[model samples]
Target: MNHSNLKIRARDERILVIDDDLGVGECIQCMLRIAGYESAFVTTAAAGLERAQSEAFDLVVSDLRLPDRSGIDVLRALREAGQDTPVILMTSYSSIESAIEALRTGATDYIIKPFNNDDFLYSVERALDEQRMRKENAMLKRSLKRVYSSRRIIGESEGILRVLDMIRRVAASDANVLIEGESGTGKELVAQAIHYASPRAEGPFVPINCGAIPAELLESELFGHAKGAYTGAVAASEGLIREASGGTLFLDEISELALNLQVKLLRVLQERQVRPLGSKHTYATDARFVAASNRDLKQAMEQGLFRADLYYRLNVITIHVPPLRERGRDVEILAQHFIEEHSRRLGKRITGMSPAMRDFLYSYHWPGNVRELENLIERSVILAEGSVLSLEDPPAKGTTAPAPGTAGEFLDRPLPVEEYMKEVVRRYQDSHSEMELAAMLGVGRKALWMRRRRWGLYRSGDSRREGTGKGDLKRSA
Candidate 1:
């Protein structure tokens, strides 16, 4: 090692050296200091083991033959004590059997007695780097557990409390789960909570949207494909099912799966094995299935859009996530949560939202559920100039209500067509049903529903926002 070229800094990683020869032990200590490392030396294995147990060490360098005991004994003692510090064994006799024994006994590296300073330094660096990586991976897993824990789901309403209770109860079981909720209602979050809290917490959580991938490729995507299976096939692949072994496979929007593909999925669920596309062999899988959908699968099966057999196979347990509109006070609570979360991320000091803005958030029917509220709050926080956030309400003629004045203002000025429509809907949605609004707007009911969804204008009491005139319009828009 080039001592002059090396950076001079305090290396806090302490290494312990155990050798019978005082000369060799002192030499190794000098080399460690030259490399800017903290180290200590003990002449006997007994003394070395004593210091190792009492003190913290990043690594240990020990002679294979000691005056009191063999380095293998020291390694075994550490392992028995549950200490994971890496050990490097040094010996004058270089034999494959001894090297294998040292490694099997948990030695990080086995070095000959006549090794060079560069080689020694290289081994030390490699061992430390591997230990660092292991620690980092452990920390990352811990952080993910905290992030996906059930407590992370933010809400205090009865609907949210019920969902949380269900998650806690279901997390102890290995049965398959089906989550039903509208888009943006945090079905995936519930799935994550279940996986992270269950025995599969340490295992992988693989999520794939059934509607995102094409029908032709979804089979291979789920079950994997052999090399040369298709036009673009180059290498054999283990599909998401195998990847989720001992973990969870979350199939989002399972209702979008084609009828033909549904039969294949049903078979896999029943057999607990997957046959890759164009492959003769089938691999067993131990993954727990967690499927989610915004649509009603029972209705879909009745319409022949989804298979009844597959539905029963995946619906071992059911979790229904209520829409944000039904989660009354949770709306304001979530809005505040997002405000604080985004404000800190964007380097702003926003304290809270204005009282009127809070009231508006509470009153407005969140057509897109939690997702829409989060996006709106994030945008508001980004554009907010003052410490408190405020919503820019439509120019109202009076405090009684903005509906009539906002509609009249749209007629007085030539605004964008969308803005005009939004104002008109806001003014009259409380009194108008879906059919009434569609007929008055000269559009179909589906078109009216899409427009309402686009503008976040679902009528009050319309939790799922089916837009089929099921919502009560007595509440103001």
Candidate 2:
């Protein structure tokens, strides 16, 4: 915390006073100020609750009886609205039962009416102290989550935020989490964020790709293999389930698991135990499962490819990562991140992207999602010749409109095959070297040389070296 804020908070604590009686409100306000606190009063419970919801206060001092409602009603409404500020109810012995009800409903304490100055001051101090403890506990929980993780979900788009909010809701428990998204959409990144924020953060996190490994070998990999259990089993091996004893096991591409293997996985989730191959003994596992897939598992189940029981077990809390095209301007954010990252690796001094490049990235539909963006940026950084990323660098594909005068324009709209190829060579033939121009047109230098010769567009002076044509190409566009 900043020391300036700390010093100010220590000197000027704020308190809210709620009482229908103006006399009572003034009396409590006076007492709070004398005790070195700033206080505000509202005459009705409705006005007081509105202030509490919209403003920040260190503690609340409220009379048990108000014109509109009892202090207990205010306390319950505050709690239901997610307000945790400490509350002290003012009461009289004639309504001892009501005061007791307020305390049970989360009032820090109750001050008896006609109480001495010492009693009232003591109650205020106690309530403020409890509020301080609550803030400290919340801060420590957030600090612990940060210490356990360097990886986090990074997109701020509405679609991405919904997926992140889902993870936040379920991360404190051991509930199984299922993440579904397209390939290259960073499904594994979501799993890491959940695992590191969870209560089992200090334990290991093991991951396996069900689609990358052979189906016959997947069972042995998950449940382990005893010595001489299979053809390549030279020694006893502990599997991923045992490896993730007290933490999480992330299974990527979960829909790729075969039907028989899905049945075995279901047993482990149901029984919390796995028996190794060629062994009679079973070992207990306390691992939380996080599964991810790009394919529609529900569709797979309907086709009788994936087991229904397994699907229901793993999808207790489902989060769908949004595709890059659907994530608004997150592509530009991620592109900047990748550009900075690769700039350091590639030893380039790049600072930022051009406006046209940023606009192009926002307009394009990224089928490969984040991974495609990262790879394309890495390639751009490697080939970049200046500090700011050149708009002409990334290879354009498909039908999106390119910035005026880019090689991307030729590829954007359809033209006759031969005319399109000749136009591409002629347009970029000046701004770039022969090799660079050839690469942009998706052809070899020899083919480029032949095209210049074939179209009679070669510069008149240097026929072989420079391919500049005699045509005043301003007429063609």
**Judged by lDDT, which candidate is best?**
1
The lDDT for every candidate, in the order shown, is 0.81, 0.76
lDDT of 1 by residue, 280-326 (tens): 99999999999999889999999989888899989999999998878
Q: Can you tell me which runs of candidate 1 are displaced by over 4 Å? A: 1-93, 96-144, 393-477
- Give the per-residue lDDT digits (tens) of candidate 2, residues 385-461: 88877567744321112234444555455564457657755655554566555444444455566567778664333
Residue 268 C-alpha lDDT in model 1:
87
Report each candidate's C-alpha RMSD, comma-separated, in the order given. 12.0, 18.0
